[model samples]
Target: MKPLKTIIVMLLLLSISTYNCNAQDVKADVEKMHQLYIEMINNSNLENIDKLYTANASIRNSDATMINGLENIKNQYKATFDSGTFTISLETTDVSQLDDNHMFVSGTFVYSKTDEPKGVLKGEFVNTLKNVNGDWKILKSYRYLETTDNASIINSVYELFSKGDIPAVLALMDDEIVWNEAESNSLADGNPYIGPDAVLNGVFARIGERYKSFTLKDVKLHEMSNNQVLATLHYVLEMKNGKTYTIQAAHHWTLKDGKIVGFQQYADTKKLADSEKI
Candidate 1:
């Protein structure tokens, strides 16, 4: 009976030793495959992908749609690169080894375009690596695309305004406009300019009169909410008296139906008075 006990114990020990060895091998292989994947990406070699992926591998986009099969991945890549040239990079954050054969890798995908001032897209990604026949391969990969923040959109609106495209600037706002001013006369008159036409006539027309020519420079945009924006303007006003006055001002805006529904302006009254020589 004691001999039998010894044999059973030895078998269990052998099994544990084998498991650890296999786990170590898998870890090493996964690391090697990671480097190989990166090399393939840098080289832009799609042909070698078959060496790292199975015929039935799957990829899930940030939108949660699963694309299956090796050919599908190739097609997706082709379509994306064709639409716009891009260079993509990956950054791994958290990695969990599920077992000797499986792992979950969390990371980020950064994309850069050929265009100047290339916009950045930041998003999360997850990749599942599987060991098949002593080789590490990507079994499933997922990624999500990030959206631009409100500040960026508001800044873009100001850029459009600076170009003197009133229609283009107004197109970004809601139809029912609410315009306010800090001046005593405009405020005392209970003047809250509403709608597009009223805004163009009552408020925007007044702006033209204040300066022979006005240009916004070094403007800043802050998004108060998804539908509201506070645009801070640094403007140079060219006066009729052959002088230029610089003013810092802010405009609060609410948007509805892709148009400016509400607007409020704020500025230093003293500075404005000095500019107008009032």
Candidate 2:
């Protein structure tokens, strides 16, 4: 009963509304896929993982192993979960809805073993998801086991230090790294060292001069949001004065572009002071 122009306008508006709704639906479905994948990995729920993939899905693991089909993927996950107690953390860096039925997602994945809390496996991954029966299911996945992000960079610093590669450790730091030593400790005399050169001169030089040996033990790195890393470690120092000290310490590192820009130290300074005179 409406005029032809009014009918055409109504149809156009309806089409636009439908397109918007479909776009929103696609985004929601893709996000759900990410959430369910993370949940399954963190919980080690292999059964649910199987359901998340298509029957003919293919996955290329970071280790270069190729797995095909839902069964094989489930078996792979089961074996991994059985081999160790671990938790997986995921962060989606980018996502694109290729079409209404397909989505592409890329993200960072980190796996931490419970027994070896300090050791972590980090990687970047891309997944192709397809809408299957109104659900987003992974059609193909590829993972690369290398990360150049802030967390990985900071972790490398500790790894280098553990290996006594001080130069390599220092190389990962910013030229103007703001290094802070724990208050009340002998090293705190420098307070905030402004540059890597200052840190090497004021902090590391002092430690080397005063201690027979200084090492970090039981180091655990936690990747937090916003380019921050938390390191829990113990400083085992043998003073040149024939005394050994073990102090619990924490380092909060802020990083940008794979370089440590800021560092703050927190420790049992009273214990450190007590050990100094002993």
Candidate 3:
């Protein structure tokens, strides 16, 4: 028999060795699981869904909707594949063991349409995984899409406009958007354009026809409370009659769920009007 102190030391070393082996195993298993998910998404393999998630698993979608149960998760993935062919890549950032039978994983993912490789969306996901028998299955998952702050959203509108991407600008507006032009401004004739289509026709189209060039200059955006953004800028415009004008302008934008829901403009309308005269 070994001495008492030697026996104790051997037991301690064995325990540490066991723990280190388990840690390595869990890390490799996590990587393999994420790789499997990517393969399932890229291949649209519905048959393998059972191996990925538990029976009562739930998902909290980025849009704030909750999908419960494995059947719904399967259906959701099916719909995703039906919409378009997409390729997904997942990167596991952290994997922590919650116990001998559970794990917490956090990772980032990027998805791109197979046809449009340049258009990709990146997001983050947190997943709770349960070890059932000898397999790991996700129990609860939550995902968030890449988001822009209020000021950034408002700033992007200007950038997109500068690049002549009118459709992209309109895409950021809510379906029931309410737009208001400066009170004395000629475009205000159609005050409170009720929708994107209305604003496009009543304000944007009219401006295009009336001005040889209309551009915003020295623009600054301020993020305000209550989901509003304030933009202080100047307009550098040339009228069709060869008259040019520079005027100060301010825009107050209200957004909801990342979409522009309301807009108000404040500017020197007198100069805008005067510039129209030859």
- The candidate that wins on lDDT is 3
Best by TM-score: 3
TM-score of each: 0.50, 0.49, 0.73
lDDT, model 2, position 66: 98
Weakest ten-residue segment in model 1 by summed lDDT:
112-121
Q: Per-residue lDDT for 1-278 in model 1, tens only? A: 57998999999999999988866766566557666666655556676688788778999876567899999988876676565555667676776789867888877777654441224456887889887887768899887776546566567677777787776665555446666777753432547766667766776677787778888877777777656888887778788887888888887866542345677778776676777773
- What CA RMSD would candidate 1 show? 10.5
lDDT for each residue of candidate 2 in 1-278, tens digit (9 for 90 to 100): 89999999999999999988887777676667777877787787776875589999999986578999988888888898887777787887887888868889888988776765444678899999888878888899998976456667777787887788877777777667899998887887887898778898998777777778988889888988867999999999887777888989999999754568899999999988887776
Ten residues in a row with the worst lDDT in model 2?
A: 112-121
lDDT of 1: 0.70
**Relative to the unseen true structure, what is the C-alpha lDDT of residue 126 in candidate 2, on a scale of 0 to 100?**
94
**What lDDT would each prediction earn against the true structure?**
0.70, 0.82, 0.88
What ranges in model 2 sit over 4 Å off?
A: 1-13, 147-278
How much does candidate 2 score in TM-score? 0.49
Error of 3 at 94 (Å): 2.3
Judge candidate 2 at residue 51 and give its lDDT: 58
